[model samples]
Target chain A: MTSNAAGAGTISYEQAGVNYDLIDPLKVAAQRAAAATAGHLAGHGFTEVKASRGESAYVVDVGPFYLASIVECLGSKALVADEMGKLTGRSYYAGIAQDTIAMAVNDLITVGATPLVVQAYWAAGGSDWFGDAQRAQALVEGWKKACDTCGVAWGGGETPALAGIVEGGRIDLAASCTGIIQPKERLSVGDRLGAGDAIVLLASSGIHANGLSLARKLVERLPQGYMTPLADGSLYGEALLAPTVLYSPVTEALERAGVRPHYCANVTGHGWRKLLRHPAQLTYRIDALPRVPEVLRFIQQHAQQDDREAYSTLNMGAGFALFVDAADGQKCVDVARGLGIEAVVAGRVEAGPKQLLIEPLGIRFGDDDLQLR
Target chain B: MTSNAAGAGTISYEQAGVNYDLIDPLKVAAQRAAAATAGHLAGHGFTEVKASRGESAYVVDVGPFYLASIVECLGSKALVADEMGKLTGRSYYAGIAQDTIAMAVNDLITVGATPLVVQAYWAAGGSDWFGDAQRAQALVEGWKKACDTCGVAWGGGETPALAGIVEGGRIDLAASCTGIIQPKERLSVGDRLGAGDAIVLLASSGIHANGLSLARKLVERLPQGYMTPLADGSLYGEALLAPTVLYSPVTEALERAGVRPHYCANVTGHGWRKLLRHPAQLTYRIDALPRVPEVLRFIQQHAQQDDREAYSTLNMGAGFALFVDAADGQKCVDVARGLGIEAVVAGRVEAGPKQLLIEPLGIRFGDDDLQLR
Candidate 1:
């Protein structure tokens, strides 16, 4: 299981060919351009909630309600699933579907909106790719299961076969969801995220759909490939492919229990660095951290990535974070526990520069690491 | 312009490498699978308006409002623009962005929902594709223009760089939109379609966003590549790259004029055959077909496609259709005209088997041709 050398040299996410430096500028430009069209919402008797523009989802002010919409792709993780399927002959589409839905719904719930409908966009290089009944059935069943888990309807979608634009036999899975936050008070745009608020870290299942490009690159160096077993005797690929945790249930439970989180962040591409994603300038002091998942540890060791690179690029076991009043911190944790989610008050918000501090690892991430806003 | 021999051989869309026969069944299966999750809407205090599924968009019943959502891809049409850009040194991404938005908003209005927000999903095979500042800026500017034209807010979207799943330097563009049908009476799910309903056909800018795979295949055989001149003295690629007509304005005008369409269909993939997309058993008899745009004529002649194959695959000049009361047909056309859309009363609905008959072309499409339901 440990045949491959852990580290001969240093490696980074950008070294594996995925660079946030090039992508972030385009995102910022796109946000500015999209802001120009927000005035159109008034034509339909709705108002544009400008605060939600750069957030995970776009929130619109409809009469008596606010609607949140988000469009997200599962990224190159589907390709990893395809590769793993070829090696083991086991259908990995179910997990891919779950990851795709999770990417969208998790972002939707960041604003405290309950997802209503999820529409899919499955663009394949060829139509024959779906001929594999087992894979196709797994994808459909998994999508339904994810939608059911999030309490959202599986709306109709488009399955386009782009022969030349997409690589043959590969499917690019993405989904867009529409959610609602009724009574308006449930809307959590981080406006109330104040100092002394508790930061509860929700446990992630595994990789959870981010940093797959780097993970796939790491597999090329693995002598055993997907068959490589972790310390727990589980296949590396299987562990990484574990379906992402659906945090919608936890958010719903928190709302039901009257524990309103001032802000929520889905720990994804930016890893634990997402802890300081709130627009306000506040230091996130993390005194504790969740146990690192085995799959992520394997990735860290194989890729020779240091703690900074690993925590900035991968989820590192923490899937989500919730900021709530100090008095309601334990209540939020209890609500998540009631929903079978392992969570704890891992940190707290403090008046300072926007930065994250990991007390155990002695690591810190400045606001510059998360350029989402 | 007339150098290529016309009708030298019988050409079908399937021969060009796209077969709806195999694609339709999967669509049917997907629709069935998605239906199972509709019950989840109840958790959000909304209901799945069952009638909206399988239509151009999925409509959900929210309190005091019905929301219509659709996720559509631009298909390989952007590749056409990419090819054209390589040849002409012109940035065609502006038109490509418009086409992507048109594909979503056109379907959105089919159910009488005024688009409130449109979110984009741009999956590129490489991150450096956006480094071409000219091309990227054109895309941003054009996307904003389309949103402005449709009077919808441009909600932010995901720009994923999928290194392996998509072709390098190429992007697969798609978008999802959420719309509102207020006063509920404006909802048009074909329930009002009757024998005497008149069908109005709106003029297409060119090929729109469908049949690009076949079109790209035809380009391989072009004698002059993108520089080939058509009878009208316009380059073939430039003609095909014409921005899709934004029909949201027309729908808005019609609704403002109190002319609610019995049903509406975006003339895209499956071409004019989309006229019979309604689940009801009725014959759409076209007494007057819109003049085939020069671009379609060029493609049909060069590809050796007959009227049947041409109209069944490409838009062939008809971009959108509105089924309305016989007396209100002229009013609808006038409304479209006021919005600068060339429209005419082209047909009428008759009680019979679900099919479309183009009287002038002597072409008929049976129910089997469109298996959307």
Candidate 2:
């Protein structure tokens, strides 16, 4: 097993060549442009939920239901899977497919929508990429299994063999899901979120799809690369490639238990900073934090990132967070536990400046760290 | 203008690295897996339209409305736009954006669904790809304009900068669309077509999305490359970058005119051979063919392909095909003309072996040419 005492220089997501400063501005500009085109939806008898513009999912108002749609891609994790496959003589594509579906469905549930259908966008460098029957069959079976897990149909998708744009021997996996929010009361875009809402955290299986660019970078510095064993005696790449937890069941069960969260956030991309995802000007002070997975701990130690940097860039141990009435936090946690997901009441919302504080770790993230809009 | 007499070695789609023989079987396998998952849709209170499995779009029976969804990507055309931008000092991203949206929406209408919302999937090699403000703004503006043209909302999308998977200096564009098929009778999946149905051909702008790999290869053989001027005085790359036609309005107008086609085929991927996209075995005999676009004509002359290969691989001139009752053929043409789209009754379906006979070009395509299922 790799030792934590071997110090490596500090690294950030930007050093891994993923600079949010350069990427977020274009996203904000696109959101502004997209807002102007909402009127076109009215012609089809469906209206855009204007508040859902910068949310994790885009919601539309149909007469009887609110439809939420999201597009998400499993970023660069497949590269890690490819490398690990070459080393282990086992295909990780099944889990890779789960990661792709989970990336989309998890975000769709954040808007309080139940996923109905998922369409895939599998673009490869060349047609020969599919010539590997083992990898292809594993991908197909995994996609079907993921759809079965999420209760969404595996709708058709595009498989374009893009030779020049995508790198050879690599495939870019993405999925778009359309979900429905019935009764219109289930739409959670943070409008009902108040200062006293309790935050319930759901445990993650491991590092999900986000921040993989940096994770892949860390592998290059390790002597054993993907084969490096973690503190738990699992290969570094195997732990990283653990299939993402399907959180839709938790939300679905919560709704069935007669508990509606004031707000929900899929802790992805920006990591713990996602607790402040809502536009409401409130403080999120966390008195407790979930146990960081061994893999994430290993990454933090090898990367030499401080507590604040690690929490803000990786999921740590929390895969999802739900804000509900102060009294309903335990019930939300119980419902998640019933679904076999580890859960805890990690924090509460308060009336203050827009920021998040981790009391245990003595970490603070100002609002500027995440400028999605 | 460069003359067509200058001959180059013959090129095929396979030589350009897109081989359907290697790609289509996986699609077939995926469809089989997808079919088994249709039972999952029952939990969402929506049933899958089994007949739509192999069609251009996937349809779901959502009680009051049949929902159709499709995922499509602009293959290597954006690469062409990138090279042309370097040579001509102009941003072709606006048209490239249209090509992406058109590629999806055109296919959506083939199943008689009217598009409601379109979400984008823009994957770049790095965050710096959006550093070019002129190109980014053109892409944004073009997306909004195309949505307005198709009367669909511009829903939120994902723009992930994939560092290692995608090639630097290039971007891959894809989109997924959710459309509504109201009244149920408007859904056309080729169940109504038998024989004596008139085939109406709609004009294409130029090489729209498909066959771009082969077209891009032709540019390499040209001394002027993308700058080579055709007989029409338009540069080769400029003509190839012409935006795809939005056929949604044509289909919507046909519905309003009370003339639902027995079937419709988006002339993409499989080219004119898409006329047999229906699972039913029928002979499509054409007495007339539309004029080949100048860019396509130049491609045929340079690549030295016979009529059968060109028509089966490229759209040539006809971008879309509609098979309707003989009596309503002129009405469909009139409706398209009202919208300024050139249309003609080019052929009729006959009771014979599954094949397409082009009398004007003496070209024949058997069922083996296209096995989308």
Candidate 3:
């Protein structure tokens, strides 16, 4: 099956995504807009070009002194939570909080920042979470417990009641995490990654949180318990709902060992667009990956999606990727192992123009998002 | 007219009046949520609670040291702008800058802060507003012009784009304004006004930017070209859209006139909630007030709302309320006249709990919001 045909086949919001043509012009517009006001637009180190008219988004120069990160993911997992509620499942919101923190904490680690405060916003149609104070308090406490486990402070969040916007008692949970970084540098694929650097794969706890929107659509069509082809087949729901693992400690150990990873990118969705945003003249070749769980295989086959599509559509087994010096690679892996997470030699960078070459599998993500633009 | 309706009788998010029971518990829950995180909250000093959990919409505060205050408002006006587009009118987002700035600036004046920056987020469905680039640029420009007129600085903002949850095609505009305030000794309705303190009234510019969700609904029921109707059949959309006058210079004058003026509050609605919040025990009696403008009269009639409901719903013609010594009452009038806005003595304090007593008009508002328990 063609990649686009399997994923993003149906036109949706990105079809309504910001007009890329207006991207450059809006930068120019924002410059003019900022000039007519008080302080000059704060300069952010990440911005490559500052333009003139309208804008897509304003990236605040939060200044590197200390960085606070706020991130949350949206997926059909909330729908699963609804199902669990009907079937009398217990973990409920606690299960969702694990994934929320998993996503937020990972963002902080990727940015070399540690989590500070986590504030969540839960929007549901007409759920009286307040009436059952125990349930409401428990939901928040569960989120706090997850944060405490990750060694981060827990803040608070808003539980908004939107009468019509939400559906089926379905709720969307989001978190804003504040992070701090006495950051020595920023991480992107473009620079540090040179040819021959070793790549390391960090084991993911189940899915490690992402692609719920894609996963939900696939699971809907699959016959229940298709993986075992037996009893009550809610395995897809349980697997897809598995909480993501927090990896702050894993990345922290690598940093403490003075093993600077040449390039690190959170690997999710077997697709290559995000990785492609890295260095323009280096090739990222990943040879080894942790065991692929059968849950993904069952869902992928049932959805009629191919291997390449499933990879980019799910995190597979590896949630994070790291590139290190070939000479110090074992030390880095040892440090990662010390943190209680499996770290294995994945592959090496090669001389090429920003490409991901999957050798053993004879697969190449080369067309739209794979090649360097 | 019920005493607690948040908007005019115009159709609103709640076709029937607000469900205070639902709203009340939400506020208590919000307070719990806010307080849990507030101890860890940094950056600003919490100001007066504007509309509390059981009472109103926002709880506004003033910033210290940074001296800048942020004014945040629910952009109900954006709904009207959207409806304008849905109907024959397209440039409906017009004149919203004043409302954006007005909502914030009004809050700033309460704490003796002068606005410096006005940033807005407009979520335009498929497009970019609730705040994308183009609207941010324009809103900033509009705020700049309005703030420049009031001698306040126009700083920048943060705009975003969201695809789901919010209505797809409508743009939702919300603002966060930052203004500079010097050390003003605790300005909470302090223990100053006791018996016989005169209440003075200042005029509101049109709707003064709140409750447009209902106003738009009422406006839609009218025929085309009805938006700009004026005496002699002249179109006056510009008049209705006029920005609320920035009262920074006048507030500064009132402070300098040795007129610690007991207490003061900006009047967005006819109800004097802020005045009641001041630390004083007196019955505020209104003796004389300027003629109510026709636009308010229309909203009052069109929505089929009477005096008290309409009073708390729309600002009517009075936008600012100040309590002063009867001795300097005329001087207060002279100052507002100097600022080119008409003002007069509306009422006075008496020997009792804070009550809004309309003497000439023969009405008494036993407002629960004025006294913070």
The fnat of each candidate, in order, is: 0.78, 0.79, 0.09
Q: Candidate 1 — what's its lDDT?
A: 0.87
* Per-prediction CA RMSD (Å): 2.8, 3.1, 7.9
Model 1 ranges off by over 4 Å: A1-7, B1-8
**How far off is residue B211 in model 2, in Å?**
0.8
Better candidate by DockQ, 1 or 3: 1
- How high is the lDDT of residue A169 in model 3? 44
Candidate with more favorable, higher TM-score: 1 or 2: 1
Deviation of model 1 at B45, angstroms: 2.1
Best prediction by TM-score: 1
Question: Model 2 over residues A225-337: C-alpha lDDT tens digits?
Answer: 88999988999999999989999989988988988888899999889988878888899999988989899999899888889889999999999999999999999888988
Worst 10 residues of 3 chain B by lDDT: B51-60
TM-score of chain B of each: 0.95, 0.96, 0.78
The order by descending lDDT is 2, 1, 3
lDDT against the true structure, per candidate, is 0.87, 0.89, 0.53
lDDT of 3 by residue, A98-124 (tens): 676666566545545545455455654
